[model samples]
Target: MCNGQRTEPCNVFPKNQYIEVGSSTEVVCQTTCVRGRVFWTLDNSPIDESLSRTINSSHTVLTLRNFTHHSATLQCHSADTQQVLGGTTIRTYSKPSKISCMLESENQHGGVPEWVKCNWEHQIISPLKINYTLIYEMPLKPKTELCHSQETNCSNKSSSGPIYMFTNATFTVRAKTTAWETSSDPYEIDPYSMYKIIPPKVKVTVLPDRLSVKWSRSGTYRICHCEVKYSKVVSDGTPEVVLKKTLGANESIGSATIENVESCTNYKISVRCAIDKAPWSNWSQEQMVLTKLNKRHVRLRLWRKIAAPEESEMRKVHAMWKEIPSTCQDTFTYTIKTTPYKDDVPGVNYTDISCDNSTCDFDVSHHAHRISLKAFQKGILLAEDSVYVPATGKSLPQVTGIQASPLGDVILVSWKAPVQPVSGYMIDWTHNGHQYYWKESKYTNTTLSGLLDKKRYNITVTPLFEDKTGRGTQAIHICSRVGDPGNVTITVDPNDKSVFVSWDTKSQEECSGTVINYTVFYGTQTGPMLNVTVDGTRQGIHLKDLSPDTQYRVYVKATSLTGTNRSSERLFKTKRFDPRLLLALSVCGSIIIILVLSLGLFCAIKWKKFSEKPVPNPGLSSVALWTSPSHQKGKGSFQPFDNPSESLFDQIYTEATQKTSTSPLATSYNSNPAGGQTEEYTEAATVVAPEEQNEKPVGQRLCSPGESTALLSSEKGKHSPYRSQSSVESPTSMSNKLCKRVPVKQLEKSTPVTVYVTLDMFEQGQSR
Candidate 1:
């Protein structure tokens, strides 16, 4: 009996886990009942029942041959039981696999053949039981044709797979499978092809008769060979090939030479290249180049001539040429045509011309040919004009001496002229180069004055002609003295107590031998004068014993053989005095004393008249002594004399007054008393001291002979000896005495004392 309970189902080949479109794939089925039949399906449709039975026995393996997108779902199941035991379902996808064909030949073209074989492999493990069809398409058309497998045997085992078949045009091949439901990638079938080949790029350079070629390869090719071609264009419009050379592949650059080319000519050149021994590329655009010719053949020539009648006559010539053609190999020829004449006439002796090719010398000395011609095709010329030759033997004169004179404002210069006279003379001189001249003249001496001192100058003398032509020799060189000495000088000579003076000579010439003596005239008063003569050649003389402090006048003269050259007299004062001024003081003293004494005598006479009257006394003594009558008669009554004290007082008063007087005689007498003296006395009754009475001389008193009383008797005895009295007394008394003693009747007039006075004067005159 069937169990009513459900049991676990087995897996169905894990649902065919990993599948691809073009490669083989497999699926397996597992069952719960052992030993039963199994079947396979695709998308729920039966594929094979017998195959699924193998799966039930644990041997189920299902594969789809050449599977494609249409065969996505696949299944395997058992057949005995209606209940699903174990089965597998598959999901399919389309992938493009190769659609291939084989080539019959590399040159065919047009449509493919009808029997072309095509085959395809599958990606599922099960064999693909689907039918496949082959399609072919041709170039330049959209139409396609399907070849049946039965008719063309495209799937036959004996046919080659997918062979390209083209009758006359190129074709494309494709295959389509039925059960797989997919198409393959298209393939092209061609028989022949073409490729572009470019020639190598090239460069060419040209020189004076040679050419250079270089090239660079491109487009995946290395240069295998190279060549250069050159030619000349003939007159017939055709090229004349001149150069052709082949070079190795390794040599990308080369050069070639063309010799003996004409000057200023042009040439044409071309270059080509090859790769791995390929055919030479067409000549590269027919490149053209040019070459230059040499220009080194040149020459030159020169000439000169002279036509002086007195001097030698000569002519010189030279010639040169350049850029000669190389084709002319011989020596170059130069021609110099000359026609010489004098005085506008072609003379017989001066019209000759000749040439020597070896020396390039053209001489017209033979007087045969009338012209000279020379030619040079190569090399150089060697001829030049004759150099000047100077004459010899010339001389010049020497300069001897020079002198200058000092004349007020002008300096006179004199020089010894040369012995031999020249055509003329030129003085080349410069003063600071600012005032310079080359003076041409006939005289040798010149005066240049009014020039400042300390300036420099250079002077040169040369003999010249009237045409300003120099003798080519210098005479001498000289210069002026810059500074000179001025003209005044003074000299002095010391003589005894006098000064001698002299001056410099003033004449233009030296002084002669003769000289004049000098004189000195002097004085102190208004007109007192004196003269002194100097010795020969002496300028001054002295006056003997002349007073000091005196002013003097002096002058000088030069007496020569010619005349007297006397200078205007000048004045000078002597040195001031010493103690010698005392004599003047003494004379002035004597005059002043005489005037003072006359004044004093006038005053004394007036005073004597005023005091001539006797003075009276009113008072008398109280007591009187009487003598005996007989003694009184004998003393003559003793009458008292005028008061002797008063007289003595008068004498003392006169002496004191005279001592203080300003009178000159008084002063002189007081200073020298013993020089003159006199004495006088007067009668007076006086009481005297004993000392004073002793000092008095015995004979100084006067006495009366009849008086015999004591006081009166003493007085008479003093008067008896008057001749022996002392002489010391007042000046007034002495004068009175002398006056009285001499009898007025006997005084006689004496002669006045004689005195002399002298004065001196001086005069001074200004000198020019």
Candidate 2:
């Protein structure tokens, strides 16, 4: 109460008061018995509603909003009494975020196999208690394994005794947190594939005075070291020291050169690799290479190396010999011989051109010739050029019909050889910025797999005749997976019981390889199902014989050699139409279309007639058409009840008619009810109500009779516009009446709820 007077019964309604998160509650408080500002506070903090407050002569409304976690004490204070009038409390809660998963391999000590671990991580559990649950997916199995250690570290290693061992199949796990549980995305691991590592493959190429051996290994395992052993294949059984070389962990697919090796000496070489602390891999198969041969060598070449002209006869030839092979220091004996370029019978002619000289020349008739010369020391044969005649310079047909298929991590290439007899075909391709080619012996098809993904590859197949390589047929492709089909649509044909489905791949460049085919799984619910596979060259299909009015669920799966991708499922209904009804509708449709055309023609004939009617001017006022003569703007605008147009607004717009007679200003002013309008603002002050003398100390001036404000105290029979003057038994009379209405607004990531708390009203000293 303010100044010992009752505050208009000051009834804080007896009901449940609930406050919702991020919402406003405007408590329209009318303090007609008191004056001055009504202060508001929440949680002992002054309410700063400066932007949303509304004030009137009799009512002061202070809006309160709960947004900062929803718990606060709201109150209205009477400035006159310096006391709390009413207050309430609010409350709210928030949910949590998602969890994540990771899979990693931890190497084991001694010689034990590695272990595969699945680790889960989640953070966001402050101000609340949270727990977790984990489950692992088993490949080709009906049930999943509920992990025992849901805390942090989990594994499918042998030592851990996991539910399932890893294999060629995919392995994945899922996890979630408690108390508003949120599931994590599936996690996958490739650790189970470690056993598939292949033995190191070593190939050797013999060079003069040395042998170059290159070896390569496969699989995802990290190689710790590679050891290679090489030795000469000598006939003696005596114990001989073997040469060895080692490559560090950073080396794979590398070469090693063995020096100090004699020419024409066959050497055996092999390689092996191992991971850290694990068992060494099996040694590669023994390979052989030969070093440079002993004794002096000779070479012969025809001057102006081109083959002799068809009509020409004479040709020039030259010969050169070496004593130490690489140096022009000493002279050696030379013998020249001739043979057909296709045959090696070198006894046709022998010219002993020896005078401690190295090179000699001669001329002869050109007839597809071969010239061979030798350096002999005491009749000892040394090195010889077996196939070094001039090239035939002949052209061969190109290999054609080349095709390349890139699977997930592999590429398969094949080609058709030309009709001409081909000795072999050379397949060429580039990968990872490196060029590689291999020879196939007259094979029509070939495959290359394990291509790096997202890489562009160009392949060429060249047909070879003997030593000649011809022009190659080329094919190009990019390695990637076919993406999901886009915009798959299902349409029904009512005239025929069928469904047409369509979709597009749009960009062949988006795929790692070509999309070869499409498989569609579709059927009516709980009815017979049919699977259809279509050629990928086409993008759509029409499925006939489908039952009418049936609901079918269909999805498209685009397939490539690498993998398959399925589109989202679509549900469609087949239209059922009776032939008779359809014919009737067709006839009616034709009639309607004809009627529309006829109506258009009639309107064309009536165009002049319509023009003959007076057209309203755009400049004319539109309001004149709605208003009656009496309700016109200026001529004593009539009330809606007085108009006779039967407009819907007859009762809604109940404005009174204008007054006919003018009265004196003083008379009109005196006729006003609110203190004759002259002293409306200068009314007598409010009065005080007496309480028990024991309520407060005596002699205290709680209220002044001269300062009492007037109240419009009216009886039930008196009129009132805003309130019901004659009221029945009110629902508010019961204790169940609600004092506050709260709305809840929550962020998309969180959920909020309403909480109710009682309002604690405070009283001031009752001064008597």
Candidate 3:
């Protein structure tokens, strides 16, 4: 060894070298000690011997052709041992090239200033991580790093100012790895050329004759050159013809008018603008517009029917036609000419018939067999047609097995071919013997469309030959074929055990079908389904024997020859009680309550009246009547008493009896002292003894029942209390006379007697 350290067996030159992609490079493996035989292997795989050349015994060279790998390890080894001695990693790289720079704005449209964005078109392939730096230089400025990134593209977001347009700048990308670094070729550009323009906003207005297009100004441009292109929107499977126009530079609101556009037509339009001479911007959003209707004449498809001659030799020719669908316009009239078959025959030539509403009727002579009709709007002919009628004769064979069915708003009619050969068939349908529609079909089946709903129609299919027509087979039809029955309604019956179920059809036309029938499905919400069938003509049915007070679900299904339709399900609850019985009980209860209240009011009023009436007193009957001995004396025969004091008592008794009836308090004597005659006497007053009368004042000369002696006393020196002592006769003498006539008795002191005297009586006695 040259030095103190031991030397390796073999060493590879260019250790860990980087090379360009798709390029060939040669590596030499040499021995340090002596001339040693060596071989080359790449990444643990043996290299081809042809690619490796041995110069002498010590050096071996390996050539890598088209090295596409990122990195590969090359090793030098002894030919005999096959062991690795020294290795060098060969890395392939690409020089970053074709760099492109642009000025980008943050906003979609032209609003914010621009930033420099540079991208590397050439990719560097290397195992080591490579750093990319975007460098830009202006005419007067030094090259500066715009951005440093590990990606292929980088933006100069950290720039202090905006990138001005029209400024010439040079951009380059420098790529570097740990071992080597390379810069891309510089790209020179003008910022103005790299700026992008936004699409303009477009608006379209539909007009009667033309379309008007307006667009907002192009991005940040004062004057813009715009182009307007439009194409008619066709629905008949035809290619659209696009029309375009180039306009000069226009101001902020750019507008263009496309003249001579078709009326009542839809068109798709777009607008694109370019700033001066720069590239054209993207097309604006597409717009659709419908032009207004123009006032134009519409050609009417004329059809007519010529009736047979009547008995009066006047044939009534009924004609009805409709306008061919086109742009809407004003009404028009028709000119009908009924020409005779021969020149010698009589006929009528109606120059003009004012049919304002598309129908005309007139009577013509029987000889007039040929008819010609022309429709005109304001003296301008729109459409014309002529027909020749053939006389009634043997008709052609009629079509057989004809069937008509309604499909929504259309009537489909099909029939078997006639026995005789025919060119085609003419299908005609009429509504209410007035409006008519007909079409020619080469097939056996045809659909009659554009018919009204809720109206009956008579359709006929007649076969047409070279010169004649076969007898037509007629069938009745209606439009708007019946779907599911409409709106099922239910009403509970008054009997509580039944419900009246009814439903409606979409129209009366749906009800005119011959094979229609209704099946009503009804049941409780959770019970098995029950059904009842009804005739198609009937709209309502009475369901009987239903459970009362139960909720039920119901629907009506209408079955026709075409299809079956069901109405929406409905819910109804049955009544719990009989309505008629409850109504009768309610009426009776109201009447009884009124009668009871009337009786109570009447009784209360009667009691109130009786309580307010004055009551008659029974204590003030006449005292003299009881004292009289003759019971036969009438009440009117009574005379005034002899003593004035007795008159006071009579007046007081009369006043008391006037206010109320008097009743006797005590019955003293009813003895027959006159021998076999009885008289009733009641004690009116108690007679006081002479000693007791003198002992007290006159007004105080009253005594209790036990202290009273008698009402009348006939003892000597006794004065009658009913009379004064100053009277001409002695009190005892008059009392004795009265006692002898009436046999008056003395009441014992133990007898209970009640004496009622007025204040006037006491005053009179005191005065005496």
| Cα RMSDs, all models | 44.8, 49.0, 21.0
Ranking by TM-score: 3, 2, 1
Error of 1 at 239 (Å): 4.2
Better of 1 and 2 by TM-score: 2
Clashes of 1: 63
Which stretch of 10 consecutive residues in model 3 shows the poorest summed lDDT?
650-659
Off by over 4 Å in 1: 1-197, 219-223, 237-239, 242-260, 295-768
* Model 2, span 140-258: residue lDDT tens: 65444544454555555433333332442233333332323445555543333233233578888876556777877543435455677877787755344344445555665767777
What is the lDDT for 572 in model 2? 83
lDDT of all predictions: 0.40, 0.49, 0.62
What is the Å distance of residue 535 in model 3 from its true position?
50
Please name the candidate that would achieve the greatest TM-score relative to the true structure.
Answer: 3
Model 2 per-residue lDDT at 356: 47
Q: Give a tens-digit lDDT track for model 3, residues 1-768.
A: 121124644567887788878889988876553444667777788877889887775677788899988877888776655656678988878878777665656666676445766677655555578899988787777787889999899976637466656577788888888887888778887665655566778888877677888887545544456777787787655444444444444356778888777655677888776655455667788898877644353334354565777888776766665553344344456677766655746344545455555567877765535566786657777677655444445445778888887777887889999878988887888877766778889999998876776456788888877645567788875444544444334444324788888777663234444437889899989999999998889888888888888898888887776556677788888889877779999999999999999999999899988887633333344433223324325565443233423212211111111112223422232233453342222223333322222232221121221122233222224322233212222334333222212223443454333344422222112322
1 or 3, greater by lDDT: 3
Candidate 3 or 2, higher lDDT: 3
Candidate order, lDDT descending: 3, 2, 1
